[model samples]
Structure formats: structure tokens, C-alpha cells
Target chain A: MARSPATSLLPGITIILAGAAIGAGALTYPLGSVFRPGPGFFPLGLAGLLMATGLGVVIEARGSDAAPPEPFAWGALAGVVLSILAFGLTVEHIGYIPATLLLFAICAVFERFRDWKRLALTAAIISALGTAVFLWGLGLPLAAFGGA
Target chain B: MDLLAGFQTGLATALTWHTLMYCFIGVTIGTFVGVLPGIGALAAISLALPLTYYLDPTDALIMLAGIFYGAQYGGSTASILLNLPGTATAAITCLDGYPMAQQGKAPLAIFVTAINSFVGSSIAIILVMGFAPAIAEFALEFGAPEYFSVMLLGLVAASTLTIGSPFKALSMVVFGLLLGMVGTDVNTGQFRYTFGLFELADGFSIVAVAMGLFGVAEIISNIGQPQSVIRDVGRIRMADMLPTRAEWRQIVRPTLRGAGIGSFVGALPGTGPGIASLMAYATEKRISKTPERFGHGALEGISAPEAANNASVQSAFIPMLSLGIPGDAVVAVLMGAMILHGITPGPNLINSEPQMFWGLIMSFWIGNLMLLVLNIPLIGMWVKLLSLPYNLLYPAILVFVCVGVYSADNNVFDIFVVLGFGVLGTLMRRYGFPATPVLLGFILGPLLEEHFRRAMLLSRGDATVFFTNPISAVFMGLSVLFLASVFLPGLRARLLRQKPGAVAED
Candidate 1:
């Protein structure tokens, strides 16, 4: 019946998001009234709504019994993010195919496929087909080899 | 007379090979995407946006429009055959569809749903033909206050009506508004949320935001889950696919009722097919003689909701094209695509660009017919797709998303921005927070702000402008009622002893 930390984290997140909204109001933007509202006016109002909503959620959570939250898939997420970051960093410098191949290999590791050859083959085919479709077919101006 | 004229224009424009070819392409791609898990029409459209840059605006519109409806046509395949809904709206189909398939009625289930989809869409198209012009005529009288007020209602309704925590939904809307406030302030020419990055000057790319949030986020989450189970399909025969006379008799009433409900529900701006299908399914269950047979391969179950889902998809276009109001996120994206094509869909669209309006209408009829033909024969092919491993599918989607987002502006920073949102969206889904509100907010935020400011300027800073105008006053009343209706039960339950019935009301 007790609310676990994982369960309680939702309200905390809502409150944090609201707090961030308020902090982003940036003081310099004029907080004009409803009549002649400034850029900050709507956002200020939104922030207030977020806070009230967050508080309501927090209050509601106090009485309700929340099931324990599922474990976050940090590994799969990290793999995807890192591969994208790697692709972003290298696509222009090292060219599209190599970067995409790197992206594929990195992402495949977290997918937990035991067959390395299949993984490599799948990665290569994806990179080649992707380049052919996006670069050559679509004329995207991406570098296939290393050089510009 | 106008109907005849509209059809003539449609014949001239939509019948062309170029338009026809693009429509074919769009629908094919849409069907492919719809049959696959972990992607919806929104993400597919986002991935296609960059590609559309090279196309004629009309052709682009035709293709994108095809994808929207085609996906709806195809989404039920996975739901029925594998108990997996490729899109949220098809979730209801899984209830009776899988049951029917389990009872050796897979082919018949597919056939009934496909035919029913055709029926639903045909009715919705007729409704669109009848009502769109009248709605546009009414829309012509809408000034800034009325526009802003209605959009406010849409925002509130979209946030509140979705399946999730109401507070989180509200927060997501506000979050979307805040995100919209980023980039240069339209009124003051001031840099608001941009942290001085040059790319931030133009604000975040809608392509990056939408693709990352919907597309990449889906891949990541789907990858985390175990692989989907595929059902054996050896027993089904071609003859079994066609509904018997008895089956046809059973489905006729439910199919007609579902289409009626769908057309009406889909016309309601700020709602989606998910709601319509659920309503249709529930209605069928309630009206059925043996309600207990509802979940266990009842023919009405597959036919009704399937029909409703497709009908809602088609009728959802009415509000978008005529009134420039999107009924859901997919239509909202379609609206964005229209804007991107330098065409603002509203009252003036009918008068100014009659060809485009009529051409699109014609395309819908042709497109629905194509889907009917395409879906029935392709059921086996779509079933084959279910055998595809989740591993390669994830990589293909991820890479496609990467390429699509990166190509939008060719900015590396956009990639990072997508990464940020992708993680946020993944986390959002993991929690109970809905993604639609944020998307709805992001799309509508700028329009709402622009209209709000314009309304304020027209009133010369009169604070009562929102209430003084009867149009805005009505919208305001609706919005307030909407919000109050959502939270009133929760508030009352907290005040009094909460009963099971009270919680079940939702």
C-alpha cells in the first residue's frame, strides 16, 4: 500500500518542470497585464498553471497507492542516444557511410543480438541502403566516402 | 451546383498522373508504416517532411494526405492478426480482432473490417462534401478573438480528453506553450528562450521536435520491450476471407451505426479516432443481444470499431480543411504541412484556391477506394511483415529518423535537440504522461499566441475583449466547462468518500 520512491518521482518531476518554467521567465521580459500582455505574460500564466497542476498531482498521490514503477531501460536508451551523438559528430567529418556504420554497430550491441556476423551484415546493409536512398536517390549532398 | 463544380475541379487536378502517382506512393508508404509496430502516421509524416521539400505543394499535400488515411486503413491488420496496434486508434480493434483470429475467423475478420472501413469513409466523405463549405462560410466571420478563443478550447479539450493524468496533460499543454514561446518574439522582435545559439534564432525545427518525440522515442521504447508474438496463419483460405450471408447480415447494422458515430465524432475538432472507435465499440457492445459475447470473436466487435476508426480519420479532415482546425495530432501535422506549403487552410481556401480544396476532396474518395482494394489482397503481405525481427526494424527506424531530422536544416545541433526530446518523450511514455498534449501544444502554441496578441491589439488593450465578444464568450464558456468537467469528479471524490463508481466514470 505504501508509495515507493519510483512511484513518488512523478509528482517530483511535475513540480520540477513547473519550477523550471518559472525560472525561465527571465525577469527582463515585460510581464504585461491581460489587456496589453507581453511575451512573458502567457508563459508566466502557463508556469502558474503548471505549478498548480503539479501541486494537485502531488496532493492526489498522497492518498492513492501507486504500483512500483517499472525499471528504466537505461541501456537501450543510452545506446540509441550515444549512437545518434556519434553520428552527429562524425557524419560530416568522417563521411556518412562510416558514421552510419558506426551508429549501427553501437546500437546493435545494446539490442543484445548474439550473432555478430548478422549484426555486422545488417548494419552494413542499412548504411549502404540508407546512403543510396537518402544521398544518391534523394540528392541529400551527404559524403559517402571520407572526403567532402 | 457547387458540388458538381467541385467534382469537375477534382477530376482536372486529382486525376492527373503526377498527383495519382504521388498518392500511390504516399498510400503505399503509409500502409507499410501502419503495418509496422513502433511508428505512427505522425512520425512517418515527420520523416517525409524533408523529402516533400522538393515536391510541388499540391503533390506534397496529396501524398501526405494519402499517408494519413492510408495508415488508418492499414493499422487494423497488426491489431487483428497479432494483437498489436500499429497506431493508438487501432487499440480497440485488438480487443475483438485477436479474439476472432484466435477463433479461426482471421480472414473474415480482416475482410469485414476492410469493407466496413470503406463504408465508414464513404459516409464521412459525403458528410465532408455537405458540411465543409457551410463551415467555411461560417468561419469567414471569425475574427481574432473568436479564433483565439476557439483555439483555447481546442488546447484545453485536447489536453483534458486524452488518456493520461489530467494534471500531466495540462502541464504538457503549458509546456508546449512555453516551447512555442522560444525563438524570436513575434511581436517585440526580442530573443526570448534561445540561449544565444544562432540556430536557436529560428527556434526549434518542427521536424526535429516531432520526429524525435514520436519517431525516435517509439523505436527506443519498442526496442526495450520483448519481441512481438506472431500468430500462425496456415488455416485461413481465400474463400474464408469473404463474409458469408449470415456474417454480412450481422455486420450491416453495426457498420452503419459505427460510420454514423464516427462521422459525427471525427467532425468534432480536438478529438481523435481513438475516442471515436472506443465509443463505437462500446455502443455496439451495449446494443448487442448477447453483450457477454462481445470480447470473444463477436463479428460486430471487429466491424464496428474498425469502421468507426476509418470514418473518424476521413471526417477529421472536414474541420482541418474548412475551418483550419485539426481534430487530432495527425490532422494537426497535416495542418502544419499545409502551412509549410504556403497554403493557409481556412475560410479563404475555398474561395481563393477552389481547385486545391476540390482536388483534395476527390483524392479522398479515390484514396479510400484504393485502400479498399489494396488492403484486402495485401492482408497476407502485411501478415508476412509481422515476421520481421524487431532488431533490424529498430535500427532502420532510428537511422531513418536520424537522416530525416539531420536533413531538415543540415544542422548538427538539430540532432542534439532531437536527442533531448527523444529521451524526454521516451520518459514521458514510461510514465503516465501522454505525448499528444505536448505535440498538440507545440503545433498550436504559435497560432494561439499570434491570435491572442492580435485579439488584444484589435481591442486596444480592452481586458474584457474575450468575454465581450459573443463568439469568444461561447468558446470561453465551453473551455471552462470542459476543464471543470474533467476535474470536478476528482475534486468531489477527495472531498467526499470516493466510490468505485466515481472512479469508473472516466
Candidate 2:
């Protein structure tokens, strides 16, 4: 569970970059006078604070005890991201039912549950329930199987 | 208004069929999620947030609040039965709850915790009635500078009080503020960081952010993890639930003390039930004559933390109701719900919206009573629910999250935002950064900036106004004190070697 020193500093480094990026973006807007501060004033101040705290973290992590995080679930991450993406991409074009089925199938593939028959049955049941609840009951603007 | 009038208004609202129906739905969902191991109250609330969009604001709030405190009552079931915590706040309940179950005293442990929870919440509700309006009245005189300073203290206190690196936590708050700044700037009507996306003008939907951080992120992390199966504890009969006379004596003092500690901690701007329960458990062990019996079926162990957690959950509403400042992340979402419903919660909330305020308070009693009934008679149902596999639950959760966010604005762009944040939240969790403060920061960021700018304008750019105003100065001083507490401990540890005789206290 012991973490490498370089890995332990990753969070601080990430925060530093985020702050710098935000601060640079803030400079494009008006800075204005202190009496009448512009839109950029608060963000610029927050950027500086963020970067400073990030630096503090970096300093504190030096020679400090560290433990590695749990193993990243790449497959799970992909499954979830893609499933949601599929729903977003298809719900309007292919409609809610197909989109939902696609989502459930993608999740099943990544989850390593190979029982397609059962997956389809559950997917159909879910699609029917979602269509009933979100479409008919709630009157969301979406068709059942065709494009909305 | 006086307490009696307030209760009457509350009862009038809470007793309505519409409010009661929603309250029942809310507590039912709350207990269901609370009995499950992986899905916490935060995720459950976010998922349910969309459905309440069409309801009355009062009903919506009653339901959301029910989910929160109801989870506290139901969380102990998993801890006592399976040694697994149903919610993060219930983690302390596992200490003696599991041991008691192993000792064939599971029914007694469960019964005592339910009773203690009821007692704890009753006391906190009394305090809420007595304190909220007074605090709100006192806060009515707050000017822009005072508001800015108090909010600064809340952000600082919230970030520093958490159990992690203060630097990391503070950075997360800053990160959240940055996220909040992405929308159209309200002052000049100029877009600050929309990046040319038309939808970004309104900024990220709070529902999207909340669901991604708490719901979708949780689902992603929970996937591929091995889950423990629940073992049969047989039927819990009514006869086995009664505690012996000695056990009853042991429960009374601990429950009262735990309620006291919980109310105090819960009323603070940045703490919540998790800390309250932990403190209650530690205090009970410290004061016990047989301290060694702790974590080994000690009757005092389960009762104190259970009472403390429930009491804290109820009392956490105090800050939100009085100052419009949420005490924790879950409450932040509840606050966001209020904003979405076009209701601003603050000093004027009680004065302006007496029915909404009092109705929400009264609903807590009804909700707690419903939970007692559900947990006792329907206990076996939840135990059976524990055996439901995560594989089936997660995909459904994913679908609900996607549909829920999309339905909020009827826009597909928000779904992508949820995806991006879901990934970001997962990385943040893995990198030792706390996510709760990020949410608190996001919700408070716009309000914070608005107050800051107004305070500056009123003072004619005199930054010292924050320090010169008495009320504002006290809050600023408190913020500094909180910040110093974070850094001083580390500095002291570096400066002096630890002596055997000197014990470090939290």
C-alpha cells in the first residue's frame, strides 16, 4: 500500500496546473478598480489561493507517510462513461427504449455478465418501466422507439 | 412568531395529504437506501431530487429532509446485522453492533438503537424550535461585510474540520469555486468562462454536479468490488426486543449524553452526524467504568452513537434554517433544492415563509415515527433487501442518473457534464482530496462572491471593513482561529519531539 514519492505529489501538481490555467483565463477579462471590481477580481483571487494551497500540499507531502489508493477500475470507468454517453447520444435519435437497452448491454459487457437472455429480459423490463415513468407518466418529450 | 403558533402552522402543513404522502415516500426511500450498504443518503437524495421538481417546495423539502434523518434510523440495521455500515455515519455503529449480533442479542441491539434514535431526534427538534427563530432574528441586522465574513468562516471551518489534509481540502474548495465561476457573471451580465457553449451560460446544473460526484462516481468505484453476503438472523420477534433492567439503566445516561453532544456538534456550520457519532462513542468509552468492554457487545456502545447520529442529523438543520449555511455535503444538496424551488433560506426565511419553515420541522416528527414503525414491523424486509446483488442495482442507478440529469433541463449537454464530473470526482477521491468541501464550495461560491463585491463597494474598497465591524470581526477572527488550528498542529509536531508523558489530543 506504500505509495511512490512521485505519485504522492500528483494531486498537488494537478491543483497547481488548474490554478495557473484559471488565472491565465481570468486575465483576459477586465480587472477593474478595487472600488468597482470587475468580473475577474474574485476568480483571480481564488486562483492565487488555490495555487498557494497546492504548493502547501506539495511541501507537506515531502517526507510524509503515504499510502497508495485502491486499484483504478478502468473497465468499470469505461463501462459507466460509455453507457451514459450512449444514452445521451441515442435517447433523442433512437429514442428512450433503444438507448436504455444499449446502456444496459454495455454495462453487462463490461461487468462480464454474459447471460444475454437474462440481460435482455431485465433491459426490456427496465425500458418499459422507464418509458412508462419518464415518458407517459411524467410526459417527457421522447418517443418510445423512434426519434423524438 | 411564538413556539406554539409555529407548531400550529407546522402541524397544519405537515398534516396535509400532499405533504404526508411525500413525507411517506421520502422516508420509505430513505430507509431503503439506508439499509443498503453501498448507496448512501447523498446519492439517494440526488437521484430523487428531480422527481420533486414539480411538487410544492414545502413537500419537496419534507421529503428530502425525511430521506436524511430516516437514513440515520435505518443505517444501524446493516451494522448490527452484517457488521457492514449502511451509511458513512453508521460506521461507528459497527463497533459493538456486530458483536452483539454475534452474541445472539441482535434484536435487543436493534431495538435499543431505534429507541435511542427516537429520543435523540425528539430532543434536537425541541432545540430547533427554541433556537432557529432567535438566531434568525439576531442575523437580520447582518450587512454585506458581516455576511461575507461569516461565509468565509463557514468555508474555512468546513475545509479544516474534515479528517484529511487541510491543504488538500482547501484546494478542493478553491476548485469548486472555480467550477462555480464558469457561468455568466451576474454583476456585469458578461460571460466569464462559458467557453462558447451556449448551455454553459447557466453553469453546470447542481443536480448534474451532485449526481456525478455522489451518485455516478459512487457507482463507478463500487463496480468490480466484492460484496459481502448477508447471513440469516431468523425472524426478530417482539418479545426478544425488551432490554433487562440493568441494560435499560445503562442505555439512559449514554443516550442523553450522546444527544447533548450531537446537538452541539450538529448546530455548528461545518460538522455533521458522522463526527457527532464518533465523538459520542469516544466519550462513552472514556466515561465508562469498564472501558475495555467497548467493541465487544457493550450495550452502551451502540446506544450512544446511534442517538448521537440521529440527534446530529436533526440539529444540522439549525444552521441551514437560521443562516442559510449548510452544515455538511448532504445538507448542501438540500439547500440547492431550496434554491431551485425559488425559496431562499436565510434570516428572513422564517419571518417570510413561516408555513414552509414550521411545516418542515413538524414533518421530522412524523417521519421519525414512520421510521420506527417501518424498522420494527418491516425489519425482515430490509434484511432480505441486503441480499440483492449490486450488479442489478448499479445499472439501474446509472440509467436513473442519466435520465434524471437529462430530464432536469431536457438537455443532453448536461449529461456530458455529469460524465466529465463523474470522472473528475473519481480521480479526486483516489488522490486523497475530499469531495464534500468541493460541493459546499460550489453551492456557496456565487453567494460568497456576491457578498464580497457588495461589501467592497459599501466600504469604498476598504478591505479593513471586514475587521472593523464588530460582528464581522468576530467571524473573521474565528476563521483565522480555524485556519491556525489546521496548521499549528503540524508545525508543533515538527518543532518538538513527542514526549511519552504528553498525549496529543484532537
Candidate 3:
């Protein structure tokens, strides 16, 4: 029989390293007494708890319907993340309008907005409205199209 | 504080033109947003949080609160009309609601949901008023140990109480706590997690994390799926709304029962309307003479869960406003918003900022009233909103999210953080791990650390102080019990396999 999916074990295991990395990064700080604990004290304890729970998940996974990982939409995932990244990196330099248009084009590719005219119209209208409200109305101090 | 005095002060503050306008805008936006599948109140509040920065603190809070409960009113509409729930809490409504719609009772189901929601909210509003002051007064005596233990209970409950794997939930909470450890340590002045970026000094951006995880992640997951809106938006007959005497008889008992269950569950640390609705539906099913009628077009099914859903949200404010512990992620985000405004919320908030507290109470009433008006007379307008293509709608949501995060501190880096968290949220959902606890852990993480450290310090280096204090010990005991209950079942199943001779229940 084919396995179902990795219910909770994978996510549980991931948090272990995530917690340890956090603790190791802050490991240089003094642990201090319980009376006057230092920066690392709390993180160290949290990391321990994370590791403990990860172990528990491993044990639980053994008795339960352990399954393989399922397929994910890599296309949708990359498109969304890259679009937001492009928006963030360019927004400060290119300003809200052009950056948003670029972000829109990147995202629209995933949605497959087949018509270029429709995509452009949607991007323009959204950017204009966003510029009007946030930039102008809220006075966020951003130029419409380019750098100050 | 006197009840009449509180309401009088609240009314005067909330009735102003600007506050009313903002409240109206929030309610309208909330209802529309709440009706959209895959977008919840958490996403809506995070995306909207930046817009409120320019307004007066009271107006901003009032608007946020409006979005909070207005979604409660509108969420069930989608669940009733389609099998799609607008938020997790509305999922129970789909059981009987979609079935009722199948029987061509869509308008009746919507109307019943509206009425039930109103009844539920009124009871919870009363509970908030009667209980919050008393709770705050009681909380004034809470020391570091009590705070630590209560938060311990909260974190444990968040991990174990939901309908998922407890271990995964616990791990996510720990990760969130670690995330909270980023930025310079307040006590030691040590920079912990910053990889040499100046923006990392303050903390990880809340808006970025929230919008990315909920808003952008939802969009990514929903991409390329056929998002069909209601087909009969303009076609519902007014005659379909009035229920028969048989249906009316089925409604009252369940609604009252649900309201009580909702208010009680709402005050608990980690549970919220979603759990309350589920429990209420289960209770309603158990008590019915014909339990088989539940998944059919039963009137009691529609009435009970809707009543519970609204009441739970209103009363969830109690723990948040009184004890500074949020009942769920949405409330945690609201608590974070309070912190962002330079207002420390706890027992002291009611004592120090009575007007702000009471004004918020009054605005919930005002916001609920506006939702009632918007929901009934203008429901068709909402259905029309539902028909907008998801492809068109989601990209706009992305733009709003981008602007919302950018406008917070006029920084682009927040958007980048959103990108990272969005991917995390997407993966978590795929793996069947709930994302809400991560948020809860993130928001509550700092406070939990502070209280634990303080309790330790106050005890003069004794870690046993958590167990020595009676109140603190009780809460800690509860947390341990919660963990045992979650683990013992899995443990028992494992043990059963080890000793296969043990008799198993049918």
C-alpha cells in the first residue's frame, strides 16, 4: 500500500534544528542564575522543549499511519515568493507604481492572465489606487514612479 | 468602574463622526473580506493594520475590532451558500447550512445565521462588560509566577487542544518562541539573531509575518483552482426566508445552549470560536432526539453553531483585555497591535485607560449593529462581491498586502520577511501542521519569557518557585494534565501494540 503523507513528523523534526540554531547563535551570552538569568537562559530552555517534542513526534509517527510527503505546487510557490521579493527589492528604488507593475507581471504569470492587455489594466488600476490611498492619502512619502 | 458610567463614557467617545465613519468603513470591508474563502480575520487585520497607523489610537482600535467581529457576522454566509468556509470558525456552519441551501432554503439559512449571530453576540457583549472588570481586578494580584504559569497553560493548550497532531503543534510554538528571541536582549543588550542587519534591531516585523503566512500563503495555495462564487446571487426569493413553526421550535433551545457554551469556551486561553462552534455542534447533535437530522437541513444545526461562533469572539476579548493573554491568534494579533500603539495591555489597562477600554466595548456594539444592517438589507451586495473572479481578487489582495507592510515603517525589507514567512506557512499547511500556534507562540513568546525569568529572579534562583506558588502551580498542573491527555492516547495505542493480549473496545 502507498503511504498517505508525512502527517506531522517532518514539521516536528524541522523545529528541532530551527530551535538549536537559535540557541547556538545566542550561546555566547551568559546563562546566568535563575535569580538573574542572562539572555541565553530562556532560549536554551525553549530549544530543549523543541527537541523533546520532536522526539515525541518521532515516537508517535512510529505507531500511527506514517506516510510519504505529497506533491507541492512548486510553480505557484516560486511565482508568489519571487514576485514579493521583486516588489520589496525594487519598491524603494523604483517607487510604488513601477515596482507594483513589475510585481503584478511576475504574479500574473502564475495566474496565467493570458491577455497582456488585461494584465496591464489590472496592474495599472491596482497600483494607481494603492498610490492614491497609501502614498497620497496616508502620506507615506513615496514618489509614484521613481526615486525622490 | 460603574457599569452605567462605563457605557456613558464609551458612548460619548464612540459616537463621534470620524470614529463612526471609520467604524462603518471597517465593518463594510470586514464583511466583504470575511465572505471570501481562504482569507480570514487574521489576514484582514494584518493587511489593514498599517492603514490604521495614521488614525487616532481609539479609531484604529475601533476599526480593528470592527474587522474582528464583523467577520464573525459575515463568515457563515459563504459556508451556508457554498460548502466553502470563509474562516476556520465558519466550517461547522457548512454541515447543516449547505444542506439547507441544497433544499432551496438558502435565504432562510442566511437569515437564521444572522439572527443567531446577533443573539450570541449580545450575550457575549454582556459577559465582557460584567466579567472583564472583575477579571482585571483579580488579575491585579497576579505576580510573575502566575503570569508564567498561565502563559505556560496557554502555550500547551495551543499545541494540544486543536484538531491536529499535538507534537507538531508544540514544535511550532517552540519555533515561534525562538523567533521572539530575536533582536537585542532587553536585559543584557546582546544582539542574538540579527545576521548583521540594522532593521533586525527592533524585531521581526509582525505585519510581514502575518500577511505573508496568511494572505500570500493562502493566495499561493489557492492559485489555479476554480473559485466559483454563488450562482444565485440575485435570485433568492423573500418568501424563502420565513421559517415554519416547526423550524422556529427547533431554533431557540440550541441557540441559547450555544451562546452559553461559546461564552464559556471563549474565556479559555487557547480555544476560540472555531473550537466553540465545533463543540456546540457536537453537543447539539448529541442532545437531539433524532441525531440523524443534524447533517440534513436541521434548523437546530444552523442556529447553534452560528450562535456559538459570534458569542465566542465577543467573549474572547475578556482574557485579552483583562489578563493580557489572548485566547487565540486573532486576539494575539490584536494584543500585538495594542503593544505597537505604545499601550501596554494587562489588568492595568482597565485601571489606567478606562475610556479607551470602555470605548472599545461600546464600539463593538456599534460595529455589531452596523454589521446587522449591512448583512440583512445589503446581503445581495455581498453576494455580488463573491462573484468577482478569484484570479482578479487575489492579485489585488497581494497589492494591498505589499502596500500595507511597506507603509508600516516605509521600509521594503518587511515585504521580504513576508516572502519568507509565506513560504513557511505554505509548507506547514501542506504538511498538515496548523499555522495559528506559530503566531500565538510568536506574540506570546516575549511575555512568557519575561514572566518566567522574573518569577525565577523573584524566587532567588529557585526554579521550584513555579511549583511552590499555589495559583502558579495549579496552572502549571493544568498544562501538564493537558499534555498528558494529548500524549496518553497515542501512548496507549503504542502500548496496545506492545501488549496485543489486552482487550480492545468496539
Better model by DockQ: candidate 2 vs candidate 3? 2
* Interface Cα RMSD, each model: 1.8, 1.1, 1.5
B309 Cα displacement, candidate 1 (Å): 0.4
Per-residue accuracy of model 1 over B1-506 as CA lDDT, tens digit each: 38889889987999999988888888887888888877788888988987887788788888988988888877888888888887777878988998998888888888888899989988888889889988888889999998889888888877766554667777777777778778888887788878778888867887888877787888777777887778676655678888888988999999999999889888876557877788888889888889999888898998888888788888988878887877677787777778877888887898888888888888888887888888877878887987888777677677777888777777778888989999988887766666767777887788888888888878988858899999889999999987886679765344223111111100
C-alpha TM-scores of all predictions: 0.94, 0.97, 0.94
Candidate whose TM-score is highest: 2
How well is each residue in B259-329 modelled by candidate 2, as lDDT tens digits? 99999988886677888888888889989999999999999999998999899889999889999888788
Backbone clashes in model 2: 0
RMSD of 2: 3.0
Q: Extract clashing residue pairs from model 1.
A: none
Q: Between candidates 1 and 3, which one is better according to DockQ?
A: 3
Minimum summed lDDT over a 10-residue window in model 3 chain B is located at B497-506
Q: Lowest-lDDT window of 10 residues in candidate 1 chain B?
A: B497-506
Each prediction's whole-model lDDT (CA): 0.80, 0.87, 0.81
**If ranked by TM-score, best first, what sequence of candidates would result?**
2, 3, 1
